[model samples]
Target: MTPEGKALLNIVILGLGFMVMFTAFGTCGNIEQTVIKSFNSTQFHGSGYTSMAIIYAVFSASNLIAPSVIAVIGPQLSLFFGGLVYSAYIAVFIHPYTWSFYTLSVLLGIAAAVLWTAQGNLLTINSKDSTIGRNSGIFWALMQFSLFFGNLYIYLAWHGKTHITDKDRQTVFITLTVISLVGSFLFFLIQKPDPEPAPSDASESLLPTDISDSSSVVASQGLGSQALDAFKKSIQLAMTKEMLLLSIPFAYSGVELTFYSGVYGTCLGAMSKFGGDAKGLIGLSGILIGVGEIIGGGVFGILDKCNRFGRNPVVFLGMITHFVAFYLIFLNVASDAPVAPEEGTQMQAYMQPSVLVALICSFLLGLGDSCFNTQLISIVGFLFREDSAPAFAVFKFVQSITAAVAFFYSNYLLLQWQLLIMVLMGFWGTVTFFVVEWTAMSTRKNSDYASI
Candidate 1:
């Protein structure tokens, strides 16, 4: 075997490229700090909150399609495309122009979307049978670095500035652009096994069969029609009480993303009246998540290992963690702290204990968040046909589409701090947890994205 094969050197190297993929997506979190700052800078003006919401909506919505495109183009080409967007539009290598800034946000959304599909496909494709499980472990473990790296990037950008000025923003953009380019170039060198053979039965299906071919597929003929068809099929298949319960966890996970990636820090700022330092806490929140992932990561694998239990318990654990974590945040904000047991005397409700509790609670929230993500992608592979890239594409698409709406509701519509609000989010996950448990999906290694 070539060194790249015997040692899987290329996959190892491309992990950096994948790192860029994640950081690209992760930059979304920084929007709360950056977008508002840009508008306030007088470099741009208006209630940019709407603009921010639109950007997020675009990011969330486009990410779904990105994977399907990645499935078709292959990872290297996708990375190249993603890199170009990062360098050109995101201007992470230099101060992006205002037009570039707006354009970059759109492109970043699209690029991030593409990266999700491409990297997941790539990583799964690259894993040699002996190494796949180990790689999966490393994949999740290493992704933590993206959060760390992104936070560091923001820190340096604001080293001396009161806020991230346009100049500072431009600097950050330029850096990522160069990095994207470098990562893109490297992808051309990495090789993996071709995806599993296209399903023979697909020839019998009404949809186009050849488009699923990775090397030959084009970007324009979207799965637009296929997406709807697949949705109906998945819905039809998922018609059981257990299937309905599986939907529960997804809602919680969706809300968690909105809160953490989309609005936690901003919410913190909204609570500025309470002396809460939202911005200062934003970067650190990732640490809480990382710490949580450590625990969840250690434990979730065992759940994935249990063949008889299927994925239910692990998925359940992840969902429960997320649900509780969000609950703490919800309660912290409302501070029914010191509910006055006697009901006659007023007590100083806002105490240090409550503050510490909220912060710790936020950390746990991140832990559950991490596990859910790890379980989620794996479950996608577990739940569907390995060769069914088209189906998984649909899966990814709905996830993004739904979450886009979730973000809209969280910040754009119901911008309030309440535990009941989280229940709405929890509804999806609660259903999903049961669905996976009750469903009879096989956990066999999918041959489609399997080995070289």
Candidate 2:
């Protein structure tokens, strides 16, 4: 096979691997709060929210050190070990316990840190300057399929049930654990790309330098010093003017991600109006969300390859779509629905809950999220081409911190307030993103003029 064919094949493999893993993990995550609530309503009241909060919190801290760890271990091994840790976290659900649940959440967070950073590194290594957007689109589109299939399983398994039974829980989680393991092992199947020859002219190169050099450099350092240096570089990059401005949207992505992935479905399950079919609706909502994401990723990916498509339009699409979804959620779902199941159904701020409106909201939220993320990935890939690992780490760090904060507040805040916050962040994030884009464009134009 040609090297280009091999690269394309590897990108597909990586996407498929993630698709399988997240099918299990993402399905489980969508229902996590509700399932945890089922464990013992009195004691585990908001433990689902709390567990998610913990995962992101640890994930946030681990990003600082994850790049160095990836440098030491290499992206492939990091992926394998990370997948194992994710599977372990899913297994904890099979025989649910508070201590084990929180403990595994912590481990999963650290694993997530390494897993995602390795993914970014690998993706960057495999892509050329022109192909980054196309590759990212393909990867994202494939991964989003997990949501559709996983939720289809849920919709089939628990469709008519008022509540999930112990037998039901055991059966579902066990299957999910197996799926996650299979996905993890698939990472082993990915053939590592041969290291690139050194660039003769660093000043003119558009692609990143090979990660092989960084790996050798880290290999020579003590582990502690490597970690400290990685952390320092990440902090420095994050403090730069462009990254600082970019962090606003990055943080907003985190907030919106939590809402669509976990909180939205939980709200659906909590409302009394849905009753016996709430679980079914949760599954359905996930299916629609996945559908929207697939459409967005596939569409944007294709358009991006066409050379005429611009990033700003996608950003605006996401902003408008999210605003619409948030407003619909505000109207159709109860304000208190996200707080906890028992106390959630007392009030609806506007229209009564309809299954149709709920599903629509889910679809829009998913589509909007895809827009924000694909653009962010493209932006980061463009701006930080030479420093992919730490750049992605800082991006994840800011994103996870905001996700943690959103989860923390999801416990205490009403649905209305949460949507309001999303609105504010969405607006601010969009504006700041434009600022950075304009600045980059201006700099590029100036450089071109100077050369002339």
Candidate 3:
């Protein structure tokens, strides 16, 4: 196969691997808070929220060292290792204990830092400026597709049951663990692009360059020094003005991610008056979220390939979509629905809960999330082409930190308050994102005119 073919193949393989792996992890994750709550032990009280918070917290801190680690082991191996860790994390669900749960959360966090940084680096290496947007959309679309299958299984398993049993949880998780293992194995099959593109001359490359090309840097330095340099480089790049500003949307994505992935479902599951199995409804909601994400990702991916799409427009659309979703959530769901499931307590929503409206909000939230994430990936991948490992590390760092904060507060904050924070973050995040994007465009245009 040609180098381009190889690159495309690698991206597809990564996407497939993630889709399967996350099918297990993400499905289980969607029900985590609810399941932990089901434990009915004071020791595991609030464990779901706390565990996820722990994962992201460790994830955020580990991102600082991810670049250095990747430099030593290479991204593909890093990915393989991360996948195994994820599978292990999922397996623990079968017989979960408090110590094992929290310990694995920490391990999963570290693994996430490596996995995502590797993913970003590999994606950047496999793409040119023209294809980055499309590739990111394609990859993300594939990955998010997990939400559909995983949740469908949940819907089938828990469908008519008034309460989930330990047996049901075990059966579901066992199936998930096996699925996760299959996905993790696919990482080992990923072959680097054959006849890899030679490192571009930094001065001639259109994007700002950094010292992250492992092949070029590691050949000349000891492993220890190379690791230190990569770490330092990531820190320096993160401190750049453009990156600092971009952190706003990155953090916003985290908050929104927390909502869509965990809190939204929790809210729905808490309300039993919706005239159907609550777990089933949550599953259906996940399916819709997947549908919305796939539509946005497919549309944007195709349009960007034809040069009919732009990042700013998509970002604007995402913000608007999210505003609509948040508004709907505020109106339809109870303000206290997400805190915990109270015994014999009636749901006190702002308005009567409509199943249709809740599902619509879920779809919109997913679509908006894809818009922000695809654009964010394209932007960082394009602007930091040479330093993608560290750039992505910083991106994940900011995102995970915010996700941790959101998860930590999920147990305390009213749904309305959380939605309000999301709105404020969405607005400021977009404004700041526009500033950097516009500046980059202006700079590029000037460079083009100078060349002419």
Candidate 4:
């Protein structure tokens, strides 16, 4: 196959592998909270939130080392190793003791950092400037399919049961473990891209270059030296005005995701009527979130390819959607309505005006999230180009840190307060994004004219 064809094919294969992994892990997103909630009620009532905080804190720290690790192993091997680590985390669900849970959380944090850093490197290096936005959108859309399938499985497994039994939890965990292993194997199928010249000559390349490529040259001197250099470069990159501005929105995205995946599901589970069948209800919510993301990403990708509305419009739309969703959620909290049961109360509960409101809110949140996340990836790849490894690392670092803090405080805050904070952050993120993009665009125009 031609190099271009091979690149496209590799992306598709990698995306499919990611889809499988996400599907397996996506089940854990809500279920983990349910498991923790159950365990906590018996043991320590709010340990679940503390666990989440610890996991994300470790994840934030791991981002500091991810670029160096990816540099040593190369993106493909980084992905393979990361996938193995993720599979290990899934295996722990079988015998989830406190120590095992915390230990695996640290491992999962490292795995996530390595996996995402490799992904950013691979995608940026392989894609052309003209297609990066679309590529990111497509990749995200495919990965989110996991949300849909994972939730579907949950819905079927629960089968209208209000509560999940120990047997049911075991069945789900075992199934997810097998699926995660399959995903790990699929990583072996991805063919690595050829290495490019070091960062000094990166401007000569037509495509975006991997910052890790520079580490390859530096590694010949020594591993420790290579790591130090990568660390310094990442710090330098993070200090740039553009990167600093962009970090706000990136951090907000993390907080938003935490709310949707963790807090929203927990809130639904708290409803007396759905409390028994929380797993199923949360699964249904996941399905809606997935559907919204698919629609948002797919539509925006086409528009991006055609250069119809540009990045800012879509981002603005996303911010607006999030604002509306947060408002709706706030209203729901204020109303404090009761949820009726599933059979006689099932349809009424399903059709409960507030439930419908929340579902719409979830869908909009997903849509807005897609818009912000895809564009963030695209913009960073475009602006940083050759420095993408450090740029992405710093991006993930800021996001993880913010998410960890949000999760830590989530237990203490009221739902109304949480929504209020989100609304304010959304507004701030939007303004920051606009400022950054405007500056970047202006600089590009000036550069073009100067060259002419």
The candidate that wins on TM-score is 3
Report residue 194 deviation for candidate 2 (angstroms): 4.0
The predicted structure with the larger TM-score, 3 or 4, is 3
The parts of candidate 3 lying over 4 Å away from their true place are 40-46, 195-199, 202-219, 305-309, 342-345, 446-452
Candidate 1 structure quality by residue, lDDT tens digits, 1-452: 65336235555656666566446445534444334444333444322233344555675666545544544555567767776765564442243335545666666667756655555555555544334444554566555556666655554444333344556555655566565566567666665454334534533332222222442223444455444543455445345343344444544555566666655544443343334333444455554555565456445542335434544565556667666766566555533311111111222223332446555765676666666666665554444333334333444444555565655555334333434566566655655565554544434345322221
* Model 3 C-alpha lDDT versus the unseen true structure: 0.83
- For 105-216, candidate 3 gives per-residue lDDT tens digits of 9999999999999899888878877678878988999998999999988888777655667788789889998998899888877775653346546433211222123465
Off by over 4 Å in 4: 39-46, 194-219, 273-278, 302-306, 333-353, 446-452
* Model 4 quality (TM-score): 0.88
TM-score of each: 0.71, 0.92, 0.93, 0.88
Our model 1 lands, by Cα RMSD against the true structure, at: 7.2
Sorted on lDDT, highest at the top, how do the candidates line up?
Answer: 3, 2, 4, 1
RMSD of each: 7.2, 3.5, 3.4, 4.5
The full ranking of all candidates by TM-score, starting with the best, is 3, 2, 4, 1
| Model 1 per-residue lDDT at 117 | 58
Name the candidate, 1 or 3, with the larger TM-score value.
Answer: 3
